[model samples]
Target chain A: MTNPGIRDDDVLKAAEQWRREGRGVAIATVVQTWGSAPRPVGSHLVIDDKQNFLGSVSGGCIEGEVIVNAGEVIESGKPRLLEFGVADETAWRAGLSCGGNIRIYVQRVD
Target chain B: MRLDLLADLNAERAARRGAVVVTDLADGSQRMLRENEAASDALLKSLNVRLRGSKSGVHEHGGKKFFVELHRPPLRIVVTGAVHVSQAMAPMAKLLGYDIVIIDPRDAFATPARFPDVQLIVGWPDNALPSLALDPWTAFAAITHDPKIDNPALKLALDAGCFYVGALGSKKTHARRVEALKQMGVSEAKIASIHAPIGLDIGALSPPEIALAILAEITLYLRKGEEASA
Candidate 1:
C-alpha cells in the first residue's frame, strides 16, 4: 500500500478529538484502488459536519464527493461504499486526474 | 468505526505499537486486534503477513470480505555498541527512514560527541530496551565485541522477534557466544537466527564499509524477509 500523506497520525486523532468536541464526524478511507490511484489503500480523509477535512484519500480528487457522501452516512448512521473512476460521469465532476479508480468506505464515528 | 475503537487505535499508535481494525465489508462490523493478539489466531494467516505493517486493504477470507486496516509505527533500528560502525550507521540508517538508536552502558563510548545525530542511550540494554518496546519494525545489531555488553542485549533482541538481529564477531567468537547464549536460556533456534559474522559479505574492511554492509543487510531483510509477501 502506498502512503503519500504525512498525516497518518493526525487524521485519526483529529477525528477522535472532533468527536469529543461533540461535532458530527465521518471517516472516509480508501479501501481499494486499481491502477495509478492517487492514494494507497487505507489512506484516510476525515470529514466533519462543517465540511472541514484533514488528510486525503485520493490526494485532491474525489474527496469532495467522499465528503458529501460522508454527510449522508453521518445522518443515516449507515456506512456507504463509493467507487470513483475517470470513467464515471458523475465522478467526472471531481474525477481522478490520474485516470485511476478508487473504492472508498465512509462511516459515521459513533 | 466506533469512537471507543478509534480511541484505542489512536492509543496504540501514540504508544508506537501496532494495531489493526478488521472490518467485515458485508455488514460494516469491526473489531480491533493488537499485534500479539493477531499471532495466535491461526486463521489469520493472511493477516499475519501484515503484523506491525502499515497497510489497509480488503481481503477475502473464508469466502467473505474483510478490510484489514493497520496502524504501525515507523521502522526503527536499535544498535547496542556505540562503536565506530554505529557512528557511521546512524546517519546512513536515518537517510533510509529508520528511527535509529544506539545503546551502550559505557559512558566512555556512547557519548554525544561520538553519536551526535542518533538516539544514544548511555545505559545497559537491560535497563533501556524494556522502555523501547522492541517490535518487529525494529532491526537490532550488537557489535560491542564484548560479551558482557553484547550478550545480554542479544538475548533480549532474540526474544523480541526483531526483524533483523545481527552481531559482529569472528567464527571462533560466535561459536563461544552461541554457547553463552544457550546457557543464558536463548533457544537454539533463536540463537541460530543471529546473523553472526553480520552483514552482507562484500568483504567490508573499514567501519563505514561495515556500516554500509550492515545497512544493506537490514534493507534486504526489511524488504525481502517477512514483509516480502506483503
Candidate 2:
C-alpha cells in the first residue's frame, strides 16, 4: 500500500534532490494555524530558485505570496516567518479567503 | 538538510522501519532517529512517545522548538481465510490504506478474480504467516472456522505481537477453539487478546456487513489502542 504521508516526504526528497542538482531550494512550512485553516500545521511547500514547487502550505489562499518570498529566501540564504490572516492588512489583497490565521516558516535548505 | 541523514532516513523507510525526523526550527538543522535508538537517546524520549502513537508535531525543548515528523510503516492486514468475508474485507481495508494479503490453501477459493489487486498466497497458515513476517503494524483476522487453518495462524500472530488478532466463530465454537488453544499451551493473557466471534456486534446478517463490522473493530483498536465491542 502507498504510505498516506508519502506526499510530504516526497516534497522533502525533491528539495534535497534540487539542491544536489545545483538549484537553490527553500522550504516553507505551516508552523502554526488558528481556526478554519485549510491545511494542518506541519504542511509544507518546497520551492526552487527557478520557481518550480511542490506541496502546499495554505491550500491555495496564500501560496503565491509564499512562493515569491521563498525565491527571496533562496537568494538571500536567510529565513523568514510569514503570517497571514483576515487581521493582516494584505489579507484581502492577497486573497486569503480562508478567514483563518497561518504562520509559515521559510528557510533555504541548501 | 544533510544528505547523509536523508539517505539513512530513506533506507529505514524502504525497509519498512519507523523513524522520526527532528528539525530544529531555529537554523533548520535536522536529525533522524531510528526506532531502536529512541529508547536510549535523551533528546528523543518525547519524540519516541509521539512516534509510538504515530503522531507528529512541533514542540519546545531546551529553549529550542523542533518539528518532529513521524514516518511509520504502512499498515497491513493478513486474512487467514479466503472466504466470502475476505472478499469484502480486503477491498474495504485497501480503501482505508491497508496492505492486504489473503491466505488459503484451497486454490479454487483463493483466486485472482475473486480477490483482485490483493496479494494472494495459496498456502496454509503455518507457512504463510512466517513468510509475511507479521509485526506490530499488522492486523490478523482468522475468518475460517476450521481449527487447522485458524489455530496455527492465530498462534503466530499473537507471538509476533500483531496489534490486532480476531477470530470468527459462534460462542460455542469460540469456547472449543479456546480449549484447543490451551492444549497448544497458549498463555491466558495471549488467549484473552483474541477478539472472538470477531467484529463489532453490529447485528450484521450478511457477509459484507460482517466484513464491515470486522474492519470497524480493527480500526477502533488501531486508533484508540483498545478493543471496542459495539
TM-score of each: 0.79, 0.83
lDDT (C-alpha) at residue B199 in model 1: 95
Query: For each prediction, how big is the interface RMSD?
Result: 3.2, 3.6
Using DockQ as the measure, which candidate wins? 1
For candidate 2, list the clashing residue pairs, or say none: none
Predicted structure with the largest lDDT when compared to the true one? 1
State how far residue A80 of model 1 sits from its true place (Å): 2.5
B-chain TM-scores per prediction:
0.81, 0.93
Model 1, residue A29: C-alpha shift (Å): 1.6
Error of 1 at A6 (Å): 3.9
After superposition, the stretches of candidate 1 with alpha carbons farther than 4 Å from their true spots are A1-7, A59-65, A86-95, B14-17, B36-55, B61-64, B91-97, B113-117, B183-185, B202-209, B222-230
Give lDDT tens digits, candidate 2, residues B11-80: 7876768787778888877888898875466877754555655556677898998877777777899999
